[model samples]
Target: MDKAIIDFFQNFTTSNHFILNNIFIFFTKIGNLGMIWILISLLFLIFKSTRKIGIVSLLSLFFSFIISNLFLKHLIARPRPFTTYDLKILIPLPKDFSFPSGHASASFASAFGIFLSSNKKSLKWVVITLASLIAFSRIYLSVHYFIDVISGVGIGIFCGYLSIKIYEKIMKNK
Candidate 1:
């Protein structure tokens, strides 16, 4: 089952490259800028009663990326897909490890964090959709394997949930 999924993603990575490439380029560019936007949004969250949740969410995401890249990547040492395949890469190859996509992890962590902090059902779906797009973008660019993106999603969701739980615990204590 796992191999089938990996094979499917690998095939899709190649077959969908054209479309994914374009979307990846756009999102990558936006992602560069969106980091700043997320910071600002986080700042806005500070003024509300939900400040603790926002901080925990943001910190959880930041730490998750740091630990993933700084520790896990080096420990696992997984290579990028292009390293093995004669794949035509659409974007410039990243210098970092590719086991778990930092972009996907960070984006989804923040989006899910916000979604959980706020009870807005509509906004949660929007954030989730955006997170999925970001994850797909990484695979589309040929920089990360299917497993990498899947790991990212898992990491992001875990950290996001942990952040929310911490916030809830803190709220109860206060």
Candidate 2:
């Protein structure tokens, strides 16, 4: 099923160079090192009302990064689909193990953190949409397996939930 989905999307890698180059690739680039999400979290931190959520996002993002890149990726060490298949990679080939995409992890972690801490429906939806796009771009660009991104999303959400629980506990103690 994963291979089938990748094969199906791989078709677009040839047919939609313009969209791939201009849009998906742009998302993929922004996901590099999870830079854009970090910037968004920082922006949220600037406002007093949003500061707690912003800090939650940063904490969750750090946990996601460490778990995805440090532990899970090393433990699984799944090679990218492009590693063995002849696929047109829109972005530069990534060197890390590919079981859990760090981009997906960080993106969803920040999104989930915002969701947990903020009451604004619009902000939550916007963050979710951006995170989904970042995760999709990984598979769209041949950098991750669909399963990788899926696992990343799950792991990231779990980390976010954990962070929020910890924060609540800390507040209660204070």
Candidate 3:
């Protein structure tokens, strides 16, 4: 099923130069290192009101990095889809293992941290939407399986929730 879904997107990417060229590929590339989300988190930190969530966002990113990149990816050691299948990797090939997509994990972890720590509903939606697209881009670019991104999303949201809980508890005690 995961291969089937990746094949569908790979076909779509090869099928239309316009959409792939103008949009999806760009997103997949942009999400490299979670740079896009990191930029957003930085902007959030610039504002006084959003500063708390911004801190949470960065914390979540940190936790996601250690958990997904440091531990889970090494432990799972899932092969990249492109390695297993004959597909053009749309971006610079990722060197790390693929079980839990670091892109998906970091993006969602930071975004959900922002969402859970802040009261701004509109910003939450924007962050979540971008995170969702980034997660999709992993599978779209042949760097990950659907299940990898799913596991990432699961890890990300959990980390985000845990960050907020810990932050709130520390603050409450202080």
Q: In terms of TM-score, which candidate is strongest?
A: 2
Candidate 1 has a TM-score of: 0.80
TM-scores, all candidates, are 0.80, 0.96, 0.94
Query: Candidate 1 on 4-81: residue-level lDDT in tens?
Result: 444555575567656755766777655542473267448746687767546766766776677566777888888887
Return the lDDT, model 3, position 149.
95
Candidate topping lDDT: 2
Kindly report which residue pairs in candidate 2 clash with one another: none
Candidate 3 — which residues are off by over 4 angstroms?
Answer: none
Model 1: how far is 81 from its true place, Å? Answer: 0.8
- lDDT tens per residue, model 2, 15-107: 866865568888888888989878988998999988889889998999998899999999988999998788988778899899898989999
Runs in model 1 lying further than 4 Å from the true structure: 1-20, 32-37, 49-53
lDDT of 3 by residue, 1-174 (tens): 998998888876677666664576777777788888788889889999877887888889989999999999899798888888898765778887888988889989998998898787898898899889888878877789999999999889988998898889888999
Clashes in model 3: which pairs? Answer: none
Error of 3 at 42 (Å): 2.2
Per-candidate Cα lDDT values, in order, are 0.71, 0.89, 0.85
Positional deviation of residue 95's Cα in model 1 after best superposition, in angstroms: 0.4
